[model samples]
Target: MAHHWYRNTTSGNSLQESLDELTQSQQITPQLALQALLQFDKAVNSLLAQRVRNRVNFRQSYGSLTTYRIGDNVWTFVPNDVEFSKVTALIKVDKVKIAACDDENTGSNAKE
Candidate 1:
């Protein structure tokens, strides 16, 4: 969805600039200049295809899901009670720091 400018390698100027130069000098017709610009764009796009392929391979090798720590004041939805007028329980969880996990002591199924 992004537009890019194609430059002519001979003069190191954009296709638009080349067209303007030709028009000013009356060297080539406007229709021929337009055709040359289109051909230059096609050649540039063909060269860009290889670079895009490399980027796809790079993304596939390194892309991964990242985990983030949940904040203590995270919100949770609770259903409203039928009989109670105001029914909302906002539980505040306390953060606890624990040492390394042990199979028997920590009640974890981790193998030694």
Candidate 2:
């Protein structure tokens, strides 16, 4: 027989149902039941990590930002002009142009 990996369940009802059935049939002791619950938690966390990794990889390899032309409303963070100031404000303004910022040109001096 081949080993089959279970699909990630969002509702968690599948694991809960299995645990309930096991308890009803008196198949698992209290310690074993606790272990099974812990294992289920680990599996769910692993699935979440895998999903985040997949999204990051996809974006890095094949993601592009749409161009924003002038007059398009956007929110921007404005730094305080005064020296030694720590205040910042979010202001709404019309975009002048759209510029691409890839890994090579995303430093502090890069224009947005």
Q: What does the lDDT read for residue 48 in candidate 2? A: 49
Clashing pairs in 2: none
- Model 1: residues with Cα > 4 Å off, grouped in runs: 5-12, 56-112
TM-score of every model versus the real structure:
0.37, 0.35
Model 2 spans > 4 angstroms off: 1-11, 53-112
Which 10-residue window in model 1 sums to the lowest lDDT?
54-63
| Model 1 lDDT at residue 34 | 74
Q: After superposition, how far is residue 75 of candidate 2 from its true place, in Å?
A: 26
lDDT of 2 at 109: 23
Q: What is the lDDT of residue 23 in candidate 1?
A: 82
Error of 1 at 55 (Å): 1.8
